[model samples]
Target chain A: MGIQLDFPAVLERWPSFLGGAALTLELAALATMFGALLGTLAAVGRGTHNALIAGACKVYVETIRNTPLLVQIFLVYFGLASLGLKFSAFTVAVAALTINVGAYTAEIMRAGFEAIPRGQIEAAEGLALSRVQIYWHIILLPAVERVYPALTSQFVLLMLASSVCSQISAEELTAIANYIQSDTYRAFETYIIVAVLYVILSLVMRAGFWGLGLVLFPRRRRLGTPL
Target chain B: MQQNTSSEPIVSLRDVQKSFGPLKVLDGVSFAVDRGEVLAIIGRSGSGKSTALRCIDRFEKVDGGEIMVCGHRVDRPDVDLRALRQDVGIVFQSYNLFPHLTIEQNITLAPCAVKKMATGQAKELARKVLAQVGLEEKLHAYPEQLSGGQQQRAAIARSLAMQPKVMLFDEVTSALDPELTGEVLKVIEQLAADGMTMVMVTHEMGFAKSIADRIVFMHRGKVHESGPASILTSPTTPELRQFVGTGNLKS
Candidate 1:
């Protein structure tokens, strides 16, 4: 007889698969929020006139972007443990993901910031707005509006990339697949199911980002115009 | 060329000089705008007209000399630039309306955040100012949704919401189409009739002759000729006469 597939055996552990999917989403959400904040700050830092601050931000962004995310996770996990800073694998996973996504976000935001016209800043100054007011009103808000589509797409990619967290035994979807496949002796079916779950998760994240963009920038929706 | 004796001048620039590397944009420029007076600055491109206006708001820092807006010395190292800005409202050639905000939000942002007015009060004030600019119907429209003239008016309303003591206009109508330019000019004319203190940088001689309390002709970063609008019609200097007589026609 030819080799037979044991698909039912994998389906029997549907609860475990579902739990893994949920954990993956949770990990992605936590990382995305913190990464966005980190990225915005880094973008601002890169744009600042201060030589030291701008240089440090540039170096940080380049270093994170050029290296592999897998290495970063391993470095964060083992490096922290070596220093006796023992954080949970989940916490380390989130940290590593945040660091990785933040660099990409910073570059996207910087491009957005650069797109703002010099005339606009001069106009705001002419109005006698305070520095914080200028930043929020003329600089940051409009820059975000201009690059919002790019930023949201990056976040969705970050969610998909969170699968790499399984390497560190984070108990997310892929990690759960590893556990279940070995237990049930059904490697191919288990991996295939996990891959489908990742695809579903990515779609959900993209939809959520699109919805958030609608709420945050109602003017674009009302006018049916590009920012 | 004497200062107005009726009221205190709200803005004064004395011997202000600004340079960009080798290019000198403003050289020994001096002018004053009295309270409730409309002063129109006219010059060809690169005549330092816009630079002189920017100096009053400290948007372009003066390399030499002093600028006083509402008695706050702008050139002084210790002066609060932001506070000076609060007193001087400026309108630009390109209406720099915040793209992300509705007209109402753009108008109310500074009043609520900078002035710390309550949100209700800010909205009410924005509505009143929008009405003043004939844009009450556009309170919810974003800048991208409006015509150029309407966008400029909203920008003017945004500045007016701050309740600045002096308003500076840098080629405010130059960016609009002829018909659209008329709409923006009409709002400015109303402001002049209402006795708002304003200094305008423009190439519109006809509008300036009709509305300006004083006409200043800038050439090569210095005041070439300055007097009443009647003087602009028959200027004394050859350069001023040539600018008003021919330049106005070509434009």
Candidate 2:
């Protein structure tokens, strides 16, 4: 027999897989919200007339984008340890993922911000909207609406990439799968099940994001075009 | 109208100069509009008429000279932009309504955010302005859903909601089709009839002649001719004659 199927062994250990998946989702959710906030701020910073703030934001985006996610996670995990700062792997994973996704989010958000017509900002300015008001109501909200699809995809990718947290023993889905596979001696079946779970998680994420998009961007929902 | 009675100018730009790198767009341009006067600036493309209107709103900072609108020194470095803008409203050729908001929301945004009006109070103001623009029914509709004329009207309503001391229209109807242009012009005419102080940069000679208390014709980045609306009928300057003649030829 070239190979044998033993999905039952993996399926019987559903509690561990379910817990791992739940933890993975929690990590993704935290990273997504925090990352989006950080990215949007960074994008705004990059657009500012102040050279120093803009330059710093540019450097942050470039450094993260240039480095591999695996290396970032390792650095975050071990760097904190080397500095004598004790932290759980889960905390490290979320921080690393947030930092990583924040960079990608910043780039996408910058594109969205750039796409806003100059007239809109001028109009807001003419209406006496303060700088912060203009940014919140006119620029940031519309920019996010414009790049929502890209943002959601980035989040889904972040969720999948969260699997890399297993290297730091983060006890997420992949880590649980590794434990289950070794215990049950059903490596092939365990991996296949985990893969299917991942696909299902991604599908659920897409559905959630699509719903969130409809709620967050009523204009887009009504017209099928970002405002 | 205030031009006929009041001596005070709500908007005054004196020797305002502006340039884009090496290109001088507005050279020593000066104009004033009284509390209820409708001053129309008309000229060919690249005549700096639009730039002058923008300077009154502080949308474009003058490279030199003075601009004072509604008691604010626009040319001064210490001038408060928000305060100056609150005293003036400017609408552009493109109806730059916030695409993400409904007509009502767009109208109410300034009043609520800038003026610090409560949401309910802002909504009432929105309803009133939308009614003024004859677009009360479109209160809930987003900008993209409206026609070009409707969007421009909504843009006007949005500005009107601010209740500025003066309003500036930068070729607001130039982007519309002939049929669509009529509706936007009608809204402006209605506002003028209500004695709203206004300055407009327009190419519509008939509309301008009918509504404008005074017309300033810019040629080669300077006010080549300035007088009553009758200037369109009897131009003292040959440049204005040629300008109006060509304008009539185009239409």
Candidate 3:
């Protein structure tokens, strides 16, 4: 017996797939921004002289990183409902994804922070810059620029992982793909198209990040240092 | 504490002591720099010259001694570091300019942030200092884009912009090549001729001989010998004679 391929049947459901892709992008965008802020703060917190804050950040990163993402999604979906805290599936998806990706971001950013040479901070101190100023201009921004590639990669993975939100009825790209395949009984074609859509989205996001990086770190661009 | 009188030394370290783990880096080290006086500290590697310089800026805490800089008690734990640093500017061997910022920003950052100087004032100050270092045209250039010589000059300009009472240079030209070192030395020489109160730790026997009002030789964490620049030509200590004896050096 021979198997035949049919992409048209899945392509016919373009509008539904487009809506799902848009929703997926929306979820990823929200999670990405919040995750970055939370992650950067967590990274700084982990490096503090305060024992309590550092320990707390350590525990947060460790617990979230070791556990599965699906469980985290389910916990936000059902556990919140059980506590009478009902939010739309979209909101729940965004929250869960932010919490999940934030841990990874913290680790990446911490490595970036640690990589900053001691001379940089010492130079800032010698200049008499305030503690806050040293952290912002000397430590955080340069560290972020140094680790920009790792950060962008983590964010792209976050966009792909938005697919898991489908399990919680978040109605993102993967959820829409499931509905289309079931309706037309064309599972293989549906997934193939979804995979291709994901690749395009990743490329688009990477391009956008590259442009932003150039604008954000003109020094790197002028020096011809690749992001 | 009483205010510092004009006749008083600008910086004084009285029997300052410092240790690193099991190693004692500074032992009963004592020295002082006066207004418009240039002091050069020369010693072999691991002689604690840099450590003693760092202590003047409170970069390293003295184990047991009194350090007075511009009337601030540096040995006290509660000393206002910002105020102390505002009066003392330090330049390091590695330039240490903020790579992410332009030269203009690097020079103006401390003044604008600490003194709350107006933007126009800081810009004028940056321009003036860059002019002083003969780097007036490289205002917008990043540190990495400049040559090592240019970068070192820019670092000196950055310290000058603070309008400090005293400047500390810790082997400022140690990391530069001969050509670059000459360029940076010229700037320092001009500063000394301008009568800026400064203490420098350096290994350039020639530069120290010509520019220093006094040269101090440190050996084994102690002041082995110290006096006028003429002392290099006629040493009173074997340690210093051996140090300057290595070559027929001249600036």
Using TM-score as the measure, which candidate wins? 2
True contacts kept of each: 0.87, 1.00, 0.56
Clashing pairs in model 1? A128-B85
**Chain A of candidate 1 compared with the true chain A, TM-score:** 0.95
| Regions more than 4 Å wrong, model 3 | A1-12, B1-5
Q: For candidate 2, lDDT tens digit of each residue in A1-227?
A: 67768677679999998999999999999999999989989999999999999999999999999999999999999999999999999999999999999999999999999989999999999999988999999988788888888989999999999999999999799999999989999998988888988999999899999898788888877888645
lDDT of 2: 0.90
lDDT (10s digit) by residue, model 1, range B27-131: 899988888889999988999998898888877778898888787888887788778878888898889888888899888888887788999999999899999
TM-score of each: 0.95, 0.97, 0.95
Model 3, span A1-227: residue lDDT tens: 77788988779899998898888889999999999989888998999999999999999999899999999999889999999998999999999999988999999999989988887788788888888889887877788898999999999999999999999889799999999999999999999989988998899899989999889898888887532
RMSD of each: 2.6, 2.0, 2.4
Going through the candidates in order, their DockQ values are 0.74, 0.87, 0.58
Sorted by TM-score, highest first, which candidate order results?
2, 1, 3
User: Candidate 2 lDDT, tens digit per residue, B23-71?
Assistant: 9999999888888889999998999999899888877888998887877
- Stretches off by above 4 angstroms in model 2 are B1-7, B247-251
Q: What is the TM-score of chain B alone in each candidate?
A: 0.95, 0.95, 0.97
Off by over 4 Å in 1: A1-3, B1-7, B247-251
Superposed Cα deviation of residue A142, candidate 2 (Å): 2.3
